[model samples]
Target: MRKWREIFGASQTDVAKIMGISPSVVSDYEKGRRTPGVKFIKRFVEALIKVDNERGWVVCKELIKSLNLNPEVIIDIRELDKPMNLDTFVTLVKGCLLTSTHSQKIIYGYTVLDSIATIQSLSGNEFWQIMGLTTERALIFTKVTTGRSPMIAVRVAPVKPAAVVLHGPKKVDPLAIILAEKEKIPLILSLASDVNELVNSLRTYARVKIIV
Candidate 1:
């Protein structure tokens, strides 16, 4: 239960909302000071499933199997450029097959391309989920710089007041941008092209200037 709280980036208050209780009640439940009924336990698990479904969690399938849940009650966001992991991918597919809404698209406006790209995994450390994954889509605008570049700014799923940054020559892609926004992972797109041309690409995502 503690692990689910972190993974969903949920607050005690959010848990209370899901469980129809107060924040203090959630704290008590977490500390094992309170014994919950079967109904409360089911609601708690369902809340976790809802959170994971929006952020594209495939492990939610395992959660269902282990818990013997109906897929119709599950929230599934499968329209990503790529699934973050195969287990999650399988879960999404399996859930979709079992659902009436198999053709729903969760992510749009991102295109995939062939290029050398690097992905970094962040520590699921406590400080990592201050912003919480509240939205299904996060919009990222990237403009690469050639010689000397302007600083880059990023916002992702679990936002922190202090920015986490990456600087290198990995050209950004629409797909990566969308994924970063969806997953709330900070990303940088390095380029060797003219700065203005790179900045112009920002028009694709938003009018906001991301001077990178």
Candidate 2:
């Protein structure tokens, strides 16, 4: 609930008013002092959807897709200030390019996600939200093993991002390389071990303004 609220840029009071409950009650629910029953959960979800729709982000559908995602996992999504080129980003991360580069694509933002959660939770359209508001953004997957799952998710998504970055020392899977070539998406493998630090570096370089 807190994640959805933050993602929608809604305040506790806002949610309380929408749900017809006291702000303290909403605070308690968020703090785990009170557990909402099924009826309240439904209302809570509706309130978030309504708030997002009114905000014109149309994030209600995206939030619904996120319901199955683990509440504990953090997905770093940000909107950057200016467009960045794929080659420049790869150089920043000191990553190896595993696939052929197409155009000097200008990326608007980047998404740092867990490969496993991406496979289990995100659908095709949901990937678009994580990739920012444009198809020219980079979808970066951390805590990856073979780097195949995230690429496969990209291949299946309704839209393909300009590039994909995989963090960790694992060798890039052959099939993943093939898929990136086929889709014409640049595939990068970063040897950086600290996923948090890597994400922070990318955020700093991209001058990301919005974090969700």
Candidate 3:
């Protein structure tokens, strides 16, 4: 519930106003002080959909499109409890930065994808699901060859990720680097031995809380 509220960029006051409830009630439900029943859950989802619809249904449309994606395309997806610095994330993933931008950015989540499965299966609109709850997250593509196709898919998408990491690519295509530079998204090359190592590293990173 809290995640969806943040994803929609809504305040507790805003949701409460629409739900005909007090902000404290909303907070109570979110914080687990008040356990929500099935009716409340239905109302909460409907309220979020209502808010999104009023705001032009941008998020709703993306979510609807995302339903078309095959499960094989996505290996893993997670939203972090706390944001982590971009530098720390790169180090955790054993990544080599390939682009100049986004040094000071923070990542809220990450999604691991099978590059071949993604490109061959999903359409332009369906790619938005990779963003997860927020675009302020890493989009790591595994089994990359030249890294061109992944970057190309990101290039045409409306929402961009905090960073892009291409795993299992010995050398990235120059065009991919150019696209990352043009988009100003920090591109990275993962130095993990294989998919297992990369996924394991990210999973470890996800569980640890950064002090800074």
- Encode model 3's per-residue lDDT on 94-195: one tens digit a residue: 998988857688997788889889878886767775554338878899999999988988898888888999998889999999999999898999999999
Model 3 lDDT-worst window of ten: 203-212
Arranged by lDDT with the best first, the candidates are: 3, 2, 1
Which residue pairs does candidate 2 place in steric collision? none
Q: Compared with the true structure, what per-residue lDDT tens digits does model 1 show for residues 82-126?
A: 322322322322211111121222322121111111012222331
* Per-residue accuracy of model 2 over 15-110 as CA lDDT, tens digit each: 899888899998898889999897688568667756765766456446534554342234665555566777777876668888876557777777
Off by over 4 Å in 3: 1-66, 131-134, 207-212
Would you estimate the TM-scores of all the predictions? Answer: 0.28, 0.62, 0.67
Candidates 2 and 3 compared: the better one by TM-score is 3
The candidate with the higher lDDT, 2 or 3, is 3
lDDT of candidate 3 at residue 157, scale 0 to 100: 80
* Model 1 segments more than 4 A misplaced: 58-212
Ranking of models by TM-score: 3, 2, 1
Model 2: residue 141 alpha-carbon error in angstroms:
0.5
CA RMSD of each candidate after superposition:
17.1, 11.7, 10.0
Candidate 3 — what's its lDDT? 0.80
Task: Give the Å shift of residue 200 in candidate 3.
Answer: 0.9
